[model samples]
Target chain A: MSSLAAPLPATATTAASPASHEDRSSFAFLAIASLFFVISGIVALLVAGKLQMPTLLGNIAWLTYGRMRPLHVNGMLFGWLLAADMGLAFYLVPRLCGVKLWSEKLGMATMYLWVVIILGAVVEIPLGHNQGLEYAELPTWLDVLVVVAWLMFAANIFMTVANRKYEQMYVSLWYIMGAIIWTAFVYLVGNFATLFTTGVNQANLNWFYVHNAVGLIFTPLGLALGYYFIPKAAEAPLYSHRLSMIGFWSLAFVYVWTGAHHMLHGPISQWLQTVSILFSVMLMIPVWTLVYNFFATMKGQWHQLKDNVPIKFMMTGTIFYLLTCFQGPMHSLRSVNAIVSKTDWIVGHAHMAVLGAFSFFAVGGAYYAIPRMLKTRLHSQALANASFWLWLVGGLSFFVSLWIGGFLQGLQWNDPSIPFIDTVKFMKPFWSVRLIGGTFMFGGILLFFWNLLATWLHRSERPAETV
Target chain B: MIKKIDKNNILFVAAATGFFAIGGILTTFAPPLLDASWAKPAPGLQNYPELAKGGDAHADLVMKGRAIYVRDGCWYCHTQQTRTIEADTVRSGWRDVRSPVSTPDEFVFDKPHLFGTRRVGPDLSRAGGKYDKQWHATHFKDPRSLVPGSAMPPFPWIANNPAELDAMVAYIQSLGRAKDWRPTHDYEE
Candidate 1:
């Protein structure tokens, strides 16, 4: 494994890289984010298992299946995934823009604010003070806190990019910039902070926000990292800069309109529904463009899949991204959605996209960037490789099991003669499979956290770490 | 070598633009094709019978139910509308042989049909006729006791308050009402 150490570029100094200070802040955020993810994953696994064996958990009011499930989701997405991605954005955006972070203090402060907002959720949601919107379930006060944190983050990033050291901005910079700015706008609008008085427009805003959070924020960041890291890791340039531009522009234009697809067959206006559906189907163009660029870039570099840990994570993520987006549009079609809308299928699809696609790339980017930034070798490539395989196997298993389970649940529910409770009975076996999948995914997450912690701690221990 | 805009890229962009244009045009000209059956008005609502005129009680119940649905965020997962037969009606209860399929016209008078698509819980479209008020109340209070492995979270607080429980039940029972409709014999109790 020491052979990996020899491959480090001699000029790559620990502190000389313009991004070292930013890396420290990013790493701190990521460590906290990883802790949150591990905690959330453990909670999810416990809840999934408890659903089948409710008596085992001794019915604590807050720990009950009803509350814990949403808590797990909120924690994982906002606390873990988004936090980690933000760390990546902070580190990568500065480097890609050919400048130092506009304000390291601002980045640190944003992290603190995020922690506070999520901590607020930890207290509020279990206390039964939620607004009851999935993803937007945080109490209205916490919602304001989150918006403020995001605004701070946006201002810092935009200012950094505006003061770039380079004249030509990379495609990755464009994506990251778009994600930060668009998220701030969408979050404000969707929360209806100004327009809504008594939370009457909660549904309209919740759907608008939750859907865009996934489509706009996470999706763009993931693609941005993919566009940057894929070529960089392969020691090659992008396949087609023009295609990347097309993908970015198209995704930006289409993703906002596509959120309403989640409300397919809803009570929303027919015009809104039709527009959402049309845009959803049209989302295929941008998705395909992205898929094409990633695959084309990897054409001659397929060998990297065997040797590079990060590439393994990233390529698999791209594949899942394709599958998730493809499935997303299909499910948006009124026909497929009828059976799978609220089922474990959508859950599976979400995980496939968010966890499977975005989390994969996020972790890969972290791993790839960490050793270089720290100017030290990774603690173990084997652990990194193991984490990749475990996540790959586990994520795929989750997607398959849940998709099938959701479809079956939908079918049984639609059968008017079948009592609703009986449909629950029918789902018992699938629920078991889902638990199994959740366990596998959680196990993988543990390995990843261990690997990351070991590397970070190991670097700190080195008395005089060198490039 | 950096190349200028080539024919291939132009063709691709043009094709994409054309697709969007055609979609916009089709949507503008034939808007009804997009209507889902769940959002459609029911026969009873569209063609009110003389017998339906006196049921202010049911209307009040429905109005109360609407409040509960909104308050609880039930619409997050369960849509009230069903789309046309071609639009995955089977999964959404629109084409279920045993259930009454809604037509587009049925929703003409609906302020906003609650026919949601996501089924975090089952569709509540025909829920009025299917389950008893007590069953719904129990299920709302604690979903797991009724459905062993439901992701649908229990709304226990709603039931703990008698007024709220009554209002919610009244609302659920009033969900799929038509102006001329009568309760099914099974639901009369």
Candidate 2:
């Protein structure tokens, strides 16, 4: 499986090397970001396990399941996933655009601001200062900080793009650019910074913001990295540039409308719900295009899935992306939502998209990009392989268990004959399964982070010539 | 070396910015797009006509029930209104069939539609016709005893004595109300 390890053409590094100072600084930022994520992953495992036995945490105010659950989520999403994505973007965008970064100062400042904002979130969310929305758990003040940080990051990236030496913009550039721009717009509107003081429009705006945060922001970034890394690792070009373009536009068109799908079966207007459902169903076109393109690119290159760790991650991430999207549309169906709209089913669906799809791609991008950027061989391919399997299995387990549990709980709750207690009792078993699945996922995350740390810390003493 | 911004890129930026501008404008002028009627003011109590009617007595019970609801945080989980659908109606037992077919307006009386987002417990929109006072009392006292894995925290203080229990039951019964109707039979399993 490791047979694809041919040394790259020496010509790849012909361009002038930027000051080593900037490269080392970027590595330092990435290392800090990686450490934060690894810590968050550990905390998530602890929280998941503690929820199974609430008394284990001994009634500490900060450790309660209600508060800690959001902490775990925010920590992982923003602290880990967003930080890694930004770090990778900083590294990859310049390379892909055939130019040096627009401003290392801006990148460093953004990183520092991000750490401060995430610190505020880590403290506030668990301290019971949340706004009570699921994904929008951070209080108004921290949210503003995030927006500012994002603006700085966006400015840096856009400026870099503006100064690109590449004549033809690559597909990866489009995906990254779209992700950043759409996220800035969506974050502002969804958070309702303008109308928020009214209080009357909070719920509407909350769902709008929460859904798009995932659909527009994280999803696009993940797809961007996936598109870039998959082909790079496979030593192949993209299957079709036209298909990638169609996928990008269609996704942008469809994802915003689908936010109302979360409000299905609620007090939202029927027309709004109908619009959401329609857009959700229409999302299949973009999702399928990307899926088809990736799979088509692998038509004759199936052997790389086992041989290359990055390909393994990308392939599995893409597969989960397809499933998450398919499940998304199905769950949006009013008939299906009637049963599982508010249950752990949504949690399972979210994990599939966030953890299974996005996290996997992020890791794959890191694995592929980091070694190249550092000009060193990975410390252990075997560990990377193991991490891939663990993450893949753990993620699958979590998805399946929660999906079934959510369905069963929904069915039982709505059954007039079955007393609500019976439903709760029925779910005890599933809750136990969820805990186990969560443990597996946490373990897998630990393995991946461990491999990453080892690779970074134990690289060959002399850096290979720039490539 | 800064590359010149091209016409195509400028056009793209204008179009993208315009899309959001239009979205914001539409969101502003759009009629309250959400159906938050359940959370709206209902001048008087409303109940399902098909269920047993309780004229003035039922209205009093419902009023008493409202007090109990405020006291117990029943609003935390159970929503009081069902939307226009067979599944909703079937689950909550509150069908609004004024004409040959039911329309969305049937739930117009609902203020701030407590049609809640999560169901930590069952829907109490139609609780008045669904269960007897005894069942409500027992369940309130200890949900786990009845429904083995119930996440609904027990309201033992409300159930330790009979007077507190009656108030709780009264609130459950008052969820939906109507005049000129009598519950034909006592609520049963």
Candidate 3:
């Protein structure tokens, strides 16, 4: 009855007592891991700010700008975002499924194993042991560990679902399990494909990995969180189960075809580019569907956003997700891709989705589940508001500065009259502005850590109506 | 009356898995089925033949440079591909260079391709003949001293290690050499 192959019994969700005592140990571990990775990310950015300065740090091989850049990227991608996602998943999945974790030990092992691998990457990648591929920068050995870790995670989730007390599965569950399967295939192939591929084939595989990893893994999982938290906070059932089905199936159908949009105008086949662009445009269907579903569910409960931090974050995240999707398809067009292909606009576009949308969803999910796990109220709503505003201002400003800077760079580079050195000069002001934006982002993340830690440690405030 | 759906149905998971596999297979595997050449680069593709002819061409320097490039995340800022578009081919006036657009065959030997995701710096597809070795050495030591207002950081660390500096330069210089292979070779086609 507790394995993935167990037969389902036609039953109502009445046997809740057996599953109520879910494991909190993995949740606590993941939460702590997320906070530390975020701190490292902040440090990496601070070093990056210095590198952009006129007198960059001198002759420290390990701390060189080039080395720091990968550390910064990986520290954030694998370290901060992945850790946060896993932490929240470990917490939310059990509660939603109405079951205890099938194996808390396996969950903890995944968390610890992931942290260990990322730690190795932060050190090894900077020391020049990288695969020289974006997102796949971690060495081959570490990649193997990652594959093992995800298998363990999938096994735990499968078994837990097998023993669930409910007969009606939620949409979030569908998205989570689907993403787990999709990303495992995407990640393994992306990381391992290079060993067999050469030249343009390898290039194609790399983009496939990068684009699908985000689309299949983060996009679906992030949507799952929004699907779960938004409705719960609104005290409403989903607006339409029919819309969820449409969104999920269409997303599954189209997202994989859209990866080649990253290779538009490159040496890839013309047909590949055309197909990718078409699918990229079609992606609007799922994105808009989710947006509509989220907004409609919030019909009368918009007022909850004032006191409810999870709802506020979830609302902002869905809007940013909308923006990211719009920007993505438009930029994927060959004409538009030709202009912004190599610009900071691409970087800015990535941040809007990864940091602005998915990160917010992860934080919102943590706020909801963390206090519940600990049987407590949030430490401070004011502080939570402060954190949200700081990230909103910081994240938006960062995107703006990079977007304008990248556009200017694109125009200047095309005009051969302008020297490349001068183009770099023009971007100095924008880089400085980006540093300031990063500092605010760090401040916001720091505040989040303090709120969570304080709440976990001292149960001082009178518990409010559980959020 | 509502029907109770099997919330934990293995069949549902199986169906989702099938959809994911089909989508991936279509975009990734189907292309190679259409054009077999894409599955593998043409046999015996030459990469940097000039560098190979230099005899000291242990590939050691270029390999080291590629590793350094990866470590320092240089690919974040600089692209090696001269894409097949007017902006890249006709008047990519960056550094006052008029470079040819890259062909698909050029990347045949790249083990882990360096088609960079962003372009904070100018594309380096034609970088080899663009600058002198001294320019690279001096620039890496202190970028602002050479070109005022440039946002590139001085890698004084690499500047101190002469061997690593040479390796980095060699790799940068070898970029876009894939097109150079076509002028002299015979293709099976």
Q: Which candidate is the best by DockQ?
A: 3
Misplaced by over 4 Å in model 2 are A1-29, A54-58, A193-201, A460-466, B1-9, B18-148, B152-189
Models 1 onward score TM values of 0.80, 0.79, 0.90
TM-score: model 2, chain A: 0.92
Per-residue CA lDDT of candidate 2, range A90-114, in tens?
Answer: 8778877777888887777787788
Q: What tens digits encode model 3's per-residue C-alpha lDDT throughout B1-189?
A: 112323545776777778878768877767766755564543433554344546656466887787777777777777877787655754432243356776666666676777887766667765654566778889988877877766676787777788889888877766665444333222111
What 10-residue stretch in candidate 1 chain A is worst by lDDT?
A1-10
lDDT per residue (tens digit) for residues A80-158 in model 1 = 9888888888878888767788887777778878888888888876665545455766766887898888888877777
If both were scored by TM-score, which would come out higher, candidate 1 or candidate 3? 3
Query: What DockQ does each listed candidate score?
Result: 0.13, 0.12, 0.54
Error of 3 at A153 (Å): 1.0
How far off is residue A323 in model 3, in Å?
0.2
**RMSD, model 2, all Cα superposed?**
8.0
Highest lDDT model number: 3
- Which candidate wins on TM-score? 3
Evaluation by TM-score, superior candidate among 1 and 2: 1
Error of 2 at B54 (Å): 34
| Candidate 2 global TM-score | 0.79
Q: So what's the TM-score on candidate 3?
A: 0.90
